[model samples]
Target: MPKPIEEIQKEVVEEFSDLTDWEEKFQYLIELGEALPSYPEDKKVEEYLVPGCQSRVWLYPKEDSGNLQFLADSDTALTKGLIAILIRVFSDHKPQEIAEASLSFIDEIGLSKFLSISRRNGLNSMVNLLKNYAKNPNV
Candidate 1:
């Protein structure tokens, strides 16, 4: 079984807490983005494109036995890392859990304050996309 969403968020917070330097945090995000598996080219269509982002981001949702899984990619490393973080917390979980998640970890890790208004809006859009998928898988 997968860990609960709260537990996963706590883990993310713990991971971010170890990096005191902002530069270190940025590098870490880049590393996280690099760690994601290469997204399939075919899924990079308009239907999967996330809006409100400065860069291109594509998110593909798949359901397996009632659990939702997300495959995402971004043209920029930082945004890719942002989506990776969301995937880590939300993927492989039940739709209800994902739809109801608070994503307080973004605040706990100081990421929100670091983001520009546009990037923040993009992040919100990505979260909304995932939540929409959870609430209505046909989306």
Candidate 2:
């Protein structure tokens, strides 16, 4: 069974807390990005592309018995790491759970302070898109 979303978020917070500096945090993100499962090449089409992001990003959702799993990739390492975190928190869960997720971990980790305006917007867009998918999984 999957863990509760809040538990996952807290775990993420604890993980980020160990890094003392922004440089270390960034390197950790890069490492997380590098660890993401390889996204399928066939799914890298226009339909899966996430908008509002300067970097090209793709998210593919696979549903199994009402739980939604996301497979994602990005042209940039930071973006990939961001999506990887989202995937960890939101995937393998019911659509309603994902839709209603508070996602407080983003703020808890001070992730926004490190992002540029455009990147922040992109991050918001990504979150919105994930919730939107949860709201309409058939789409």
Task: Give stretches of model 2 more than 4 Å off.
Answer: none
Full-model lDDT for every candidate: 0.92, 0.92
Query: Which residue pairs of candidate 2 clash?
Result: none
- RMSD to the native, candidate 2? 0.8
Give per-model TM-scores: 0.97, 0.97
Report the error of model 1 at residue 117, Å: 1.3
Report the lDDT of model 1 for residue 94: 94
* Cα lDDT tens digits for candidate 1, 1-139: 8999999999999999999987888889889999998899999999999988888999999989889989999999999999999999999999999999998999999888998898899999999999999999754
What is candidate 2's local distance difference test score?
0.92
